[model samples]
Target: MTQAAAYSAARRKLHWGWITPPVLFAAIIAGATIGETRIPVATVLQVLGNNLLGTDYAVGRIDAGIVWDYRVSRAVVAACCGAGLALSGVVLQALLRNALADPYLLGISAGASTGAVAVTVAGVGAGVISLSVGAFAGATLSFLLVAALARAAGGGMGVRGAGVIVLAGIAGSQLFNALTAFVIAKSANAEQARGIMFWLMGNLSGVRWDDVWLAVPAAALGLGACLWHVRSLDAFTFGAGSAASLGVPVRRVQIVLIGLAALVTAAMVSMVGSIGFVGLVVPHAMRFVVGVRHARLVPASALAGAVFLIVSDILSRVLVPGQVLPIGVITALVGAPAFALILVRGRAR
Candidate 1:
């Protein structure tokens, strides 16, 4: 290639890299400002400035509270959840060497749901542990169980291992989902069951700052861990033997990255229920733009996922005026079709 042409390509790549972060930030701000009450973008910024920068601003108390306390928090949580789930999806797909692997597909979300339902509906460990804690515990346990089953089934870093893991995940998801149903059916009254069902469908309606605090750091840690092992992930693409020969400590890296993915999935699922598609679709969609390298794919998928979910959350709120639709329903409506398309495109390739 000519030097000028190469330079232009480099410039384009640099431009995209620089522009994505700001664009995602703008999307989050837009999401925060464009909710039911319709806070202006400027007002949202001013409210955030007042709190974060100690800047004097004259936004109304209600508007300020709505922006700072509720809308912004919800937007942040949505971004965190989206990024975390997308990162998890990328890691799982890379680690397992499978395009179809995702946190939900691996039963983590169902496990977290079972845990949350046990606390919220069945009143198990309610006083001793919060709902989020219970959900994380459930998710961790589910992941452990799946890991054990997969290992026992001779699952490792290849197609055979990927198949075993998928099968185990399907089994685990079904088992936990049934347990969740049973808990709700036996323990919850009619009204409580209705509310539990809505939560299970993934409502982010009443998100507060606490939710944001919980989700954001967990996502950050998970993403950081994934990025730290990007080189190993790339090596694993060839095969476990190749990766091991390259000094990647293949088994340890797999366990750590998968664990991180599961942890992030649990954190998000505990807060938002099992909102699907962000993890599965975002990584696949970003791959077309950022290429297959985990180093680029991880961050690109994270940002794209955040933008997608924030937009989805906005649509969920505005689609029915005052009524809020469960975010999971919107994701499923979008993800199922996108997943089909990915499969078709994969087949074509």
Candidate 2:
């Protein structure tokens, strides 16, 4: 492709990647409201319109108030969580210079899960608010631990040194996982253990709209901060030394960018369960379409991530008979093959 043509392609991919997600998210939410009944798309919109503005339109009617209520909230939760994870992926990959690194690789999700479980099993009111808050606290604490540990192991290398981060993240995540398991196993309540297990697997069902509003500002703050660092991220592609030579404050930018990314990620994980792989896959796929420039890549990844989990969550509804699956499982089932394909293709190139 010509230089102009390549840039045009990148911009087009970014536009399509961004647009396609919201449209797909809307479709999934609409289709899933019917559950196994599979209502038409127009009907879904009509019901949505009715709920929001009372336009007296009906393509279909679900008799269960609880079902639709749970579904709408779940859909919103999944979309926001997916977007957060994708942006975290972009930020972490840029900051660490490791395509293999993910938001959870640093143990943020594990820490959040541990905190949520502690609240759940400690006879604290298992309300959504309590669990979310506890989980957020855990995630932030985990980020600090990782930063401290990574800094101690720095060996005078720049923050973007891939080898140190990969080792540090693996160790940190394993530590938190062990703690989470202990909490679950030691709890005397079977139901609570099962509930904690399910929560760790990730589910967006049964979320309240009020919880949605509480998380909105955090999400915006995280995403906006990442966008502001897009220029630094692009400079990062050339490696820490090169970016420094170009006058980029490499370490300072890494701390700021990754810190913001982790904060948003922790908030999302607190609200939703520890959904995985969205971060690892979505950014990689978007990169294929829109080079490695963070300006285009970050927004495109966010949109793609939103669509991906929404569709995955909807599939979890129908993938089995007379039951629903954790939305996380569906993403792994679907994203694994797609992620593999991307990796294989990249190697072939």
TM-score of each: 0.91, 0.85
lDDT of each residue in 300-348, candidate 1, tens digit only: 8888888888899998988898889999989988889998998898789
lDDT of 2 by residue, 51-121 (tens): 87778864434532433566666677677778888888888887777887787787778778777777767
What does the lDDT come to for candidate 2? 0.75
Worst 10-residue stretch by lDDT in candidate 1? 8-17
Task: Give candidate 1's error at residue 187 in angstroms.
Answer: 1.6
Cα TM-score of candidate 1: 0.91
Cα-based lDDT for every prediction: 0.86, 0.75
How high is the lDDT of residue 44 in model 2? Answer: 60
Residue 59, model 2: lDDT of 48
User: Candidate 2, residue 345: CA error in Å?
Assistant: 1.6
Best by lDDT: 1
How many angstroms is residue 78 displaced in model 2 relative to the true structure, after the best TM-score fit?
A: 1.0
